[model samples]
Target: MQQDTVLVVGGGPAGLAAAANVNSAGYKAVVVEKEDVLGGAPILSGYAKLVPSGEWAKDAIGRMVKRVEDDANSTVHKGAKVEKLEGEAGNFTATLTNGESVQAGAVVLATGFTHFDSINKPEWGFGTYEDVLTTTQMEQMVASGKIACPSDGRVPERVCILLCVGSRDRQIGREWCSKICCTVSANLAMEIKEISPETDVFIYYMDIRTFGLYEDKFYWKSQEEFKTKFVKARIAEVTASGDGRLLVKGEDTLVKRPIVIPFDIVVHAIGMDPNADNPEISQVFGVGLEKHGFLERAEQYTNTCGTTRKGIYSCGAAYGPETIDDSIAQGAAAGGRAVADLHALVQKAG
Candidate 1:
């Protein structure tokens, strides 16, 4: 009965979507992002092209940003982290590190995910070999134009793609599937073939998990049309050659023999992690985390975004693995749910 303000935290695709709805419904809502700019991981992501559906993510997020910018009711704060969050349902206050505070009746936490640094997986020879690179590094390089091997400065004669480096592995903390890696790697392989048909491309994966839709088609196309080679195996190690080439050692599990493949460049399709500050976010908002470290929602169907805490909700990778499209969807859903709760409070006040 006091006030109705909903705070949306994070400015990624999901956060942006959530903010749009929160503003449209005439709720006093603000979006708080820790970065200097609004967009979360995708903004800094080096992906050459968007994933699954292959929509340029920058362009997609650009449209979402414009919506937030045009809506006068929506307030966006860049370069700020919620240092403290307090209060209960229909009343919460977020204290920012920059000495600013945002009061709200509800809070939507959309803090996104972070990439696993390739260097952490030393067995991939990421740091030791100049030719070895992470998928992010490859995207950045491809974006820069000439896609040449870092080792020899030549159009790579052969390229090797390793999947599930940080993802789907129990050795690393991330045991669950990151979901997007296989498609992205396959797309990059195709792009490499398109650019230089002469160069050989090999993808070593334990299982080629093309889950649905056009992605499955793309996987098939890579095999039939592009002639991209696939090896169903788990890589053992990557050793560097004196002249900057890389030797990838893995067992072709299907064949039951050790296979050593050499290449001018080696790319590690690294997985994702909860945003580095996930624990901090959990502490600040008083939300619980899943065993896998994502936000644990109160209920799957009824409260897609609402947390165990009364006034706080979570969306996007803060909750778990999601595609750009799903993140946007979840964001919008969270926004509507929070606004509905706040609106009910407003109605009672009236």
Candidate 2:
């Protein structure tokens, strides 16, 4: 007989939420995480404050981790992965890397996304300059309560944030927008200004996309209250000046003029990429990958979280780039759906 359990792959926000929901639905949840610890990118990457909520990542995602771990119906296997999946629908056998096997009624894949590496675009000066940093690195600095240049440890008088790094660029074949970069950058600008009141923050963007409610809270607030400068431009390259400052070469699209500006430090608002383990995941789980390489949903309208294979579901960044709040909600939806479907299958068999 198959166990009344759901196997949740990954230990990120989505996976944890899914497991918690499954446990609440009176079913067991077996979470398999490759990392030694949980919390996924937010904790692993050391994210500072979250968007909209402004809560520290550790505090917010930590609660999700705790909720699942503390539950009696939840079994967590850290530093392990699902090596192979067999059977189908309400009776699936998953062999873990640690030589354990779980007979789960359903499966939920929440293997999150990978942050775009700036080194892929050499002209951005990320690997080339000590002062140039990605948003993740900059976030660590903000968390440390200081916005100083990594090169000389000096408080930068001027800082430039270049948006759309590794996103919406046909040259790199990453055409989809990362979704959260705009709001995050805007919020980061305010945080930088708050920490270093004397520092002037400039955001260079092709388009400012603080969509929906974020328009007023982040974009406009950063400009109106925090006095952050928004520039309509496309950066060409970044080079070091003789004086050790960085020179950003770009065109001011508003004025249709070429410009080069010097800044003490430059930041790249990096985009999200598909998880690096996607190829291996697809092969192991027998799930089809969408055109962009994210797990393919069975059908968008009827089954929002259903994966290509039956009895398997996917949510969060595994489907595409997603916010943490949305990922958690989707995880719950997927978990509830899987449990409901499992019940229906059992009733049919009986």
Please provide, for model 1 over 1-350, each residue's C-alpha lDDT reduced to its tens digit, 9 standing for 90 to 100. Answer: 22557788999989999988888787766888888877677766745667666666577677889899788888888898899987878878779988998888888889888888877788889898888888888777766766788866899989888999788877777788887778778887877787778888889998887678745666887877888899988787999766667899989988999988778888898887877888888888888888988888899887777898987888888887777778998999899999898778878876
Task: Provide TM-scores for the models.
Answer: 0.95, 0.98
Clashes of each: 0, 0
The top-ranked prediction according to TM-score is 2
Clashing pairs in 1: none
Clashing pairs in model 2, backbone N/Cα/C closer than 3 A: none
Q: Write the per-residue lDDT of candidate 2 for residues 122-141, one digit (tens) a residue.
A: 99899999999999999999
Worst 10 residues of 2 by lDDT: 1-10
lDDT of each: 0.82, 0.93
Q: State model 1's lDDT.
A: 0.82
